[model samples]
Target: NLCSKNKINPLIGSAGVSAVPMAARVSNKVGLESDAQNFLLMHAMGPNVAGVIGSAIAAGVMLKYVLAM
Candidate 1:
């Protein structure tokens, strides 16, 4: 809904946090369904990787504090 209102690609949000390449591939597939020329895999991958890194960092921080206790 937000993507539709903001005119942003829904794939960015959908592919940001899980399944990494799989989500990007799914987004690319959906984009291709709409327009064969609209290739979005690369774009989706950017946020996907960033999300994974951010999640990893957060997990590390949480684990560090948990272990200290």
Candidate 2:
């Protein structure tokens, strides 16, 4: 939604999952299919990497609390 509002392809934004570079590659491939010059890999990767790290941190926190309980 943020990407859509900002005028970026939603596909790229959605690629920001915990899957990392694979998702980014898929986004890039899809973008290239639409337009040869649509380079979205690097842009998508930014969010992808962050998502992985964030997910890891979140999981750690959840586990810590669960184990404590």
* Best-matching candidate per TM-score: 2
Tens-digit lDDT string for candidate 1 (1-69): 644556777767778875778988898999999988988989999988988999999999999999999
lDDT of 2 at 67: 100
lDDT against the true structure, per candidate, is 0.86, 0.87
Candidate 2: segments with Cα more than 4 A from true spot: 1-6
- How well does model 2 score by local distance difference test? 0.87
**Residue-wise lDDT of candidate 2 within 7-63, one digit each (tens)?**
667776778799967999998998999999899888999999999999999999999
Q: lDDT of candidate 1?
A: 0.86
Model 1 misplaced stretches (Cα beyond 4 Å): 1-7
Best by lDDT: 2
RMSD of 2: 2.3
TM-score of each: 0.81, 0.84
The alpha-carbon lDDT assigned to residue 60 of candidate 1 equals: 100
